[model samples]
Target: MFHTILSQLVGTAIALFARVVTAVRGVWQGVEPVPRQRVYFANHTSNGDFVLIWTVLPPALRARTRPVAAADYWLTGKLKTFIGREVFNSVLIDRNPQTRREDPIVQMVTALDDGASLILFPEGTRNMTDQTLLPFKPGLYHLAQKRPDVEIVPTWIDNLTSVMPKGKIIPVPLLCSVTFGAPLEVIEGEDKAKFLARAEAALAALAQEVAR
Candidate 1:
């Protein structure tokens, strides 16, 4: 009980700090912030990307949303492990296939089964290049195929790369916007390649909108 309370306090403090640093705003262009189960797939640019999204969500939704993050990174240190597991209640997946004990897709589906919305980065890693987005990994496709009922929303996070650049401990104060695009789904009989391509395009389109 004390641990749960401490986790909630820490989570609130983190959200407040993120807002102070980034002045982040949520722009729902294609969907409402209703109480619907959703998979929020965004472009990966910084470690703080999911935090910005979580900060912008309504408190009720934020309570139920979990970020699907890397187990190796979050579990390495004691403080990070506590924050990732207790504060955010993240679904941590081992990115290494050879040493992983469980399938990443099954882990995600289990979270969905437990009625938690997800903040996912389909790129599977931070895009550190000039490209607006890296090609998406197949995990998003498999997740959609497994849970066809859940809404998958394309999210575009702007100005975060500048705010929290690679290897920077202190984030520069910057105005950031998280644009939530329309929800998409797998079409009937859609192949993995085609479905992933369409999902990528949908997310890329939101980036274009943010550019304007």
Candidate 2:
């Protein structure tokens, strides 16, 4: 618990810096309290996605929202190691070494069982695409279905893809906007494929709102 709190404090400081930079360069708006238990889905464009989402979350919720990050990336180096273990309280999963992604599902499910909300990128890997409302991996849909009480929130992160994009580190520091659409409810008896498609569509609509 101490580690989690420390991370929240550190995360807040980092976000304050990022938000100021973002506001100066561009407009940063639309940040609000997320509905509890919501699973966030966004297009993966930059390393900045994790920090952006972490900073935007309200102080209280930031304590509980766990970002599902890649183990290979965040688990290795000393700095990555500290951020992952201390501040972010990330659910670092093996995205590359395993033959199957289901391995991460088990780990995430255990976290949810403990009542943690998640900041997840539905795209399993970052792809170079302007329009990236990718077909979400079934795991997100399955998790929602298993725990119907959870609020499945579809979020779109606008400008992060182009602002920092991929393969660049020194965040050009643009105003990255986060749009949270209404929670998606899993209809009773809905199949996996149908549920996943609807969730993707919801995120697309949220992105449209950002564009306006």
Candidate 3:
């Protein structure tokens, strides 16, 4: 009980700090901040991408949403482990197929079944290159196939890569924005390649919109 309370306090502090540092704004373009189960898939550029999304959400929705993060990174240190498991209530999945004990899709589907919305990065890993977006992995398609009823939203986070670069410990003060685009669903009989293509296009288009 004490740990739970401490976790909440830490989570609050983190969110507040993120807002103050980035001046993050939430822009709902094609959707409203309504209560519904959703998978928010965004471009992967920085590790703090999910935190910006979480911070901009309404408190009610924030309580029900969890970020999907890497197990290896989040479990390495004591503070990271506590924040990942307790504060953020993240869905940590092993990225290594050789050492993983469970399927990533199954873990995500289970989380959705339990009524928690997710913030996912279809890129599977952080984008450290010059590309606008890395080719998406098939995990997003599989999760959509398992739960077609859940809405999949395209989220575009702007200017975060500049705020906190790859290996920077302290973040720079910058204005950032989280844009939520229209929801997407896997068209009936859509092949994996096509669905992933459409999902990627949706996110890229949202980013372009934000760039305007």
Clashing pairs in 3: none
Ranking by TM-score: 1, 3, 2
10 residues in a row with least lDDT, candidate 1? 184-193
Per-residue lDDT tens digits for candidate 1, residues 28-97, read: 9999999899999999999999999999999999999999999999999999999999999999999999
In candidate 3 the C-alpha lDDT for residue 63 amounts to: 94
| lDDT: worst 10-residue window of model 2 | 23-32
lDDT of 1 at 108: 95
- Candidates' C-alpha lDDT: 0.94, 0.74, 0.93
Candidate order by lDDT, decreasing, is 1, 3, 2
What TM-score, over all chains together, does every model reach? 0.98, 0.86, 0.98
Segments of candidate 1 deviating more than 4 angstroms: none
> Relative to the unseen true structure, what is the C-alpha lDDT of residue 135 in candidate 2, on a scale of 0 to 100?
62
Candidate 2 per-residue lDDT over residues 46-112, each given as its tens digit? 7777677777777688778889998888978888898887888898888764454657878888888
TM-score of model 3 relative to the true fold? 0.98
